[model samples]
Target: MTTKMREEIDEIPAAAARLLDTQTDLIRDCANALKKADPKTVVTIARGSSDHAAYFLKYAVELQLGLPVASLGPSLASIYEAPLKLGHAAAFAVSQSGASPDIVAMARGARAGGATTISLVNTIASPLAETADFAVDIMAGPEIAVAATKSFVNSIVAGLAIIAAWSEDKALVQAVDALPEHLQSALALDWSALLEPLREAESLYMLGRGPALAIAAEAALKCKETCELHAEAYSSAEVLHGPVSIVGRDFPVVAFAARDRAEASVAQTISKLAAGNAACFITSDKATGGEKLPFIATGHPITDALALIVPYYGFIESLSRARGFNPDKPVALKKVTETQ
Candidate 1:
């Protein structure tokens, strides 16, 4: 039987295409609003997989626009009732359910603080969407699995579209336009090389840099959430600082190296770890020592990094079943976590 997770993973490409095709007007409206505001900074609100998507966008916005982006803690409004001074900033609130109380509260607070609030959400009827100055439906459709697959990808796709339109970057716009096809190619990749080692391993490390670091983080979270594996994500540079001490023979490491300035650095770190007898695998042709995992390059750094997650989603769903667990209904987890 095909798992719900697998079905949703297969839906990613179509979901992205739907968002790009159906929500063009909303995305452009948000982008134009941002251009008018010309904010000095940007802030994001999210949690769980949505937070990981926001982290990806943080790098994209900073790299493309040279504007700093920060993640705002939702507790300020939901738990502590603290006032936010975001008069000169833009707030991006991301959520699939769009019903998380903290996330919605924070979006409302951001608007009250005078920021231009934009929401990228899967549910158009959600409170978060109603509260935002501009709302973009991510168009990922109904995701039945507990672990997000298509919705997560669509959230990032929506944000990237907004950034591409806002900055008027022809290169990024082209990349965004081609993402659906790239995502289809990404789904066809084989990452089974990671399975046998991870099956018996007690723990593992996921490494990357720049936008790929966000991919690593999402990978680690999926490992824990679906496969019940103990996986930690780190910057390729940061892992060597202190975490390398425990890396001994056959310590599994997966490095997500996109075709970007950080690719060589990540590959170098993987090489060092491989030299230490760690079973290192990297997703770049430039790798010197570690085994190379196949990945589709989307001709742009950000899109290339985003494509890494599709194959990983398929891999983790299979790993979960191989480890005697259901990927759809992870233990003690529900679809919507309404944290106050």
Candidate 2:
């Protein structure tokens, strides 16, 4: 039987297309507002999968716009009641449900701190949207899977669109427009080679650099939430510093490498780990001894990083089924986590 997770994974390309088609005006409007604010810093507020999307956008904003971005802990506003000094800053908040009290509180705090607040949420009617100065509804549409698939992808896409518009990067704008086609191709990628090792493994490490590090984190989370596998995500550079101590024989390591500046370093790390007898797999073909998993290149760094997750979502869903767990109803998880 096909799972809800698989169905939502298949919907990703269409969902991305629909988001671009429907939210272009909102994205442009938010970009115009951001341009006028000319904030020197960008602050992001989120948690869980939404936070991973924030990590992805942090790199894009810093790289393209040359403005440093930081993620603000929701507890700062929710628990500590601390005030942020963000007068010369902008905030991007992402929540699928938009009902989390902490998330909503932080967005309000950002706005009160004089940041131009923008929210990307699936539920436009929720409090987080109302708290922000601008809200772009990421039309992911009725995600039934407890583990977010399309919404997570669209959240990143929506943020990228706004950044594209703000920076007026013609190439990134074209790349964003062309992502549906790349996403369609991404679904066909077969990562079945990873199944045998991951299914039997007790724990694994997922590594990436730059924006792809966020994808690695999302992939690692799905493995635990869906398959009950123990996984941790780390940057390709940081993995060798401390985490590489666990890289003994047959230890599984999945390294995500996009066609960007960090690719060579990631490949080098994967190769070194593979040489140490770790069951290392990498997305790029440039690595030595590491198994090559197929990936689609979107010709832009940000989109290329986003595309890596499509096949990974597919892989983890099947891995979940193979491990005799329901990917849709992960034990202890609900579709909408109303965290305060």
Model 1: residue 308 alpha-carbon error in angstroms: 0.4
| Every model's TM-score | 0.99, 0.99
Residues 253-301 of candidate 1: C-alpha lDDT, one tens digit per residue: 9999999999999999999888888998999987778788999989999
Off by over 4 Å in 2: none
TM-score of 1: 0.99
lDDT tens digits, residues 103-215, model 2? 99999999999999999999999999999999999999999999999999999999999999999999999999999899999999999999999888889999999999999
lDDT accuracy of residue 24 in candidate 2: 90
